[model samples]
Target: MDSMMMGAMSKNMESMPDMGMMDMSVMQACMDACAACEQACTVCSTQMMDCSPACMNCADMCNTMMRSMMRMQGMTPASMMAMLNACIAMCQVCMDECMRHADDSDVCRMCAQACQACMDACMAMKDMMMASA
Candidate 1:
């Protein structure tokens, strides 16, 4: 998203007391990573490999996580933490599954990379939230 959109989103999220200290840059990075992971997983799922199921599931999870972050009006810190945990867990599974075929499949390798990036971004968001809490 553009800076203006992020600023607007941050303004909207400021209504939540627990989100007052949120770092917009970290949030934007997390959202961007989620979107990239979702797209990578969706493409990887079409490879019809052993990791297909995990890829599909991860794609859905990432999409949901990204959407939830974008619509933060009703989200509490606890709920946000839970969502990040779930996204991290899903990314881990997908990354592991994709890595299994990474030696032979470029798509799987790319998907694994995307999953790793998403996990890292989510972790950063979690750590930032904890520190601000």
Candidate 2:
């Protein structure tokens, strides 16, 4: 799904001036990270732990972020940056919450790892955008 979406997005990039300078691989990585994080959060939320609320919220945010990336025609560089920041923030909160119970719960540990990966991917996207700007 991600590769297909990225291929379509890459085709559309010809009409987006600044987008031509963007790294499609980085964008693909970010989208993949968002998807993985969403899944991890959904699974973690089912654990009924103290991090459940954060996990749920992070999952929703990640899904929204991933969808926004897919619909680049509706996004500006500013909006993309804002969405990335929001996603990173949500991931941070979720990661922190999950980490609190990581010592006792494997699910929490995995969720925290996913959140960290999502945050890193988001930051990479942000950095790439900034560099291109």
Q: Compare the candidates by lDDT and give the number of the best one.
A: 1
- Across 20-116, the per-residue lDDT of candidate 1 in tens digits comes to 5999899999999999999999999999999999999999999999999998886888999999999999999999999999999999999999999
Give, for candidate 1, the lowest lDDT window spanning 10 residues: 11-20
Q: What TM-score does structure 2 among the candidates reach?
A: 0.95
lDDT of 2: 0.93
Highest TM-score against the true fold, candidate? 1
Clashes of 1: 0
Q: What is the C-alpha RMSD of each candidate to the true structure, in Å?
A: 0.9, 1.2
